[model samples]
Target: MAEETDHESKTEAATERRVREAIEKGDIPFSREAPVFASTLGLLIALALFARGQASQLARDFAPLLDDPRGFALETGGDAMLLLSRVALAAGRFLLPILLILAVCSLTASLLQNLPRFVLDRIQPKWSRVSPMAGLSRIFGTSGQVEFLKSLVKFLSVSVVALLLLRSERTRAVNAMFVDPSQLPELILTVSIRLVSAVAIATIVIVAGDLVWARLRWQRSLRMSRQDIKDEHKQTEGDPSVKARLRSLAQDRARNRMLANVDRATVVIANPTHFAVALRYEPSENPAPLVLAKGQDLIALRIRAIAEEKGIAVIEDKPLARSLYDAVQVDQTIPAEFYRAVAQILFFLFARAR
Candidate 1:
């Protein structure tokens, strides 16, 4: 009841992240009926291809014993052991091919549905696996009820197929009873193959339906509540407060780095106290003057103070300072349009030094 209530609360379809996580955790939709259907089909194929030859070989091996049971003596332990080994070998030959076919078909069926992955969580022991309540809930749950209904339908359908095949072959079956015992294996193989082929055809519809059902059930199980989506978003994108703090910290670090580059400036263009643009120029190193730092107001005053302390030239040019501060970025070249204005400042400072 609690589980059902929880399931009902998940009204929204799961997000891509939710689906991906579910798959990583080894939660995937798999239809048990797919493998059953494949094995049943494999059984039919085995009966058609191999059963006839094996059964004939088996019958031939056992014919002498069946024809004259009293003539073959089992008087000693050695005689009994010899007979037993022969019987075992003949039985193995008849059954081994069919068993192999079933095994291959079952494996292929499973692989077609889901890729193989080793998930430790699936193998780990859990309390729910041993709990009586859990076991009972699983046995009587929606999935269990559906499985029961499907199995009942499959059994009835297979039975009907067998009955119909038997009805059609009644004459041949009766005639085989009076025919040579050696020919009985062939007669039985024909009927078995026909019955399995009919049943296999019937199972095709059931398997296709079950595959669709399993996928829908799995998707429904992965559905999320509105709260669940919000929580998942937070976990994926992180807390808003924390993101803001991080952005602030990054800005502070960049500002400090820009301020530290003030001492390397060849010229500091200042709009008195309103703006400052510190530039470094070397014709050999770069084609244009690089803006080392730019700031406004208090930061402008700080840049001017740092320029005085480092003995770098500071020229008050309101138009150039404001334009460079707006147009240039730290650690980037000034535009060609500002080249003449900045070059005039550089020439004046160099001439004074000379």
Candidate 2:
């Protein structure tokens, strides 16, 4: 039960690296509704722009065939084949713009939701996808159920909207029936465009809502377990114990270097056991005394021992040692606040040497 609880608890949000890895694996947020919405919009626009022209062209092209089929020299096989070819060419040219519009709409819709990316892994076939159990699970899964429900709702809603719009346009449609025969096509085209536009706008609202929900669900699905977070941190930043060992090794090398410089120090001021600061001054080259090294506790003992071994003076002035250790750093000149005390010590050492 304890193990189960631990496994169930995925409270941590996924890291950026995790999300990026998922994208590389082609596991990304997407909404099927967006493409549907885009295609509908594209179709509506294409129809609005080209419908009347195409209708007129179709009427003109086929008018002769419809009015007087016997006028064609169809008794010859060559003439019949030529007529069929011309019809095919005309139909292809007429539909090409709408097809192009739909393709562009689908591509643009996908690009807006997710930046273009190609992952070979997504195209590779997986055994799980072909498994009977997997298929059954997908059909019964929470996501599948939700998708089905959403489709049903969309179909019902669109149908109701379309019906209501058609009812509203009933009077105009009836009046168009009595209009001049040539004008009837234009009237029907106008009403059809308006109805499609209304339906497309309504579908856009549904698609927008689905997109927001899908994104939230995608993020939630990517949430990390506590152990997963820990593993990623280790992978990115290295193990804590290993890092601590490296830090300790670096500190030891720096301390050895600092102790070696203590041999050049003119004087060492000590807090006896807790702190030590070593000072060096060159009258011709240095404007003020410089701290050669400063340390506390174990490091302080090592600094004092090095000073004694090098025959450098070691003085126990608690207040001055603490002040210098606090205010000065290794290889830096003592600050003005500590100048008087440090200068007196340097002067006394010089006098003794003389």
Candidate 3:
């Protein structure tokens, strides 16, 4: 009941991060029946194409030993060993193609559903994997029950197919026993082709249904709650509090650098208590005077104090101080629009210096 409630609570689709992490952990929708179906298909193909030829070849190769047993004698260990080697080589030659076909088909089936990825976490030892409760939960879980139903369906379908084929060919099967030894291979190949083809046809439906079910279950498992999305957003972007704190620290460092440069100002414009803008001018250095520093309120007071300690000139012009602080940036030339107001200030300061 609690599990169902939890499942219901997760209404949102899985975020990209969640999906990526799941894949990194080797969690993917894979149909077990697909590989089984592929192996069956491989068997059917090999039986149809290669089985008749190989069986005949093997039969011909063994004809001497089987047809006239008295002609061959294993008198010594060397003779026995040689005979065993020949048998092994012949069996391997007959079976190698079938084995290769099965392997390729199985791999292709798996790759069609999900690409391969190596994840150590998948193979790592985990207590939950071996836990009794976990094992039982898996066995009795809805997913397990669904799998059981699928397996039951596949088994019944394949069994019915086998039974029907056997019933229909019961006479032929009995008569096969009495056939010539050389003809036995062809008869066996015919029966195998029929049985494998029937089984393959019957299980195709089960495999297709299982593939869809597996994908649905995997997607359902990935569903996230609203809170989960919020938490992931914080992790991927950044926490609000931490970002604010970082912004604060950056502003403080910039202010300190500005104050340190205030000592180099030729003059400081101030509202006496609220605003300050420090300007530095030299005919050879820049086309217009550059503001060395500007600030309001507490920062303005700090800039003024720094100027006073360095013995730099402080001019009180409440209106001009406000405008300069609004429009000017430290280390940047004052705007051309402010040229008249600022040139007048420099003229008065230069006259006072003389």
Candidate 4:
């Protein structure tokens, strides 16, 4: 039963369950990309933009270097070793900010998702890792199909944006060659902004779609089978056989206890077919006589067994036994109306004893 119950629990725990739980709790993320991915993407974009800005500044600053012989000499390098060092230092300085930003953003993303949970399952080796056949299968799997579609869409989207930008600025770009250089920066910024915005919007939409897909999958995984619910109910309520055994044990214990006290009972009254009750009197203390034991069917047989074992007289009083069983509980005094009827039975018992 335990094993069956465990299997049922496992079956009910599908990926969809997690998605449903997340949705119910409002714990689902806005996009499929974890904080780390979002931060990394943001950092990469920021860095790229910074790099472009820095390159522009460098071009504007060093624009006059080409006109001056000494400045040109300094830019080109007089000392071979020093020139290489300078160029390396300049490259590092230009790129370092973006690299640092990306690293920080990546860390921030990881932090948002709760850093370094370090689940061993993620690091474990599997047949898929070593199997070329499996790798090929996965590549042609549903996941691969989705990836292929995504790539195709991305390529088309980027191409469309690129064409639009080039088409819109074609005349200005050609005309800017002889025009004031100020117009050139404005044009470049406008084109870059439009392209970046389009790409960013596309990326957001794709990521959002992926998140939705994941949520759907999670919900599907959580679905419970009919068998699973039934098994869980059995596990929680206990097995039918065990419950029956427990009930039998309880009856046996009660019978034993009642039989042990039967020798002290004053009278055993019976409905003959259905109910039986035993009553005892302690006139020295109790205000009224109390019922010693009561039961129906097999329990009535058990009451008779105890009474016969103890040599207590069992009277086949059908009406009195049934009334007492219905109106009174074990260890309680009989009601007033039943008292007069019971007195007559006690008088008869005493007359027989004499």
Ranking of predictions according to lDDT? 1, 3, 2, 4
Ranking by TM-score: 1, 3, 2, 4
Error of 4 at 36 (Å): 9.6
Q: Which candidate would rank higher by lDDT, 3 or 4?
A: 3
Best by TM-score: 1
* Whole-model Cα lDDT of every candidate shown, in order: 0.92, 0.86, 0.91, 0.70
Cα RMSD (Å) per model? 3.4, 4.0, 3.6, 6.8
Estimated TM-score for each candidate: 0.84, 0.81, 0.81, 0.65
lDDT-better candidate, 1 vs 2: 1
Compared to the true structure, candidate 3 yields what TM-score?
Answer: 0.81
Candidate 4 stretches greater than 4 Å from native: 1-118, 171-190, 221-225, 228-264, 280-292, 315-320, 323-354
TM-score of 1: 0.84
- lDDT, candidate 4, residue 26? 46
Candidate 3 lowest-lDDT run of ten: 64-73
Name the regions of candidate 3 deviating beyond 4 angstroms: 1-5, 62-90, 259-264, 268-276, 284-287, 296-327
- TM-score of predicted structure 4: 0.65
- The residue-by-residue lDDT of candidate 4 on 202-314, one tens digit each, is 56666666667655654444556667566656776888888999999997897778666766888899987688898887789576778888889988887888888887889
How much lDDT does candidate 1 score? 0.92
Query: lDDT per residue, candidate 1, 84-174, as tens digits?
Result: 9988998999999999999999999999999998889999999999999998888899888988889998889888888888899999988
Stronger candidate by TM-score (1 vs 2): 1
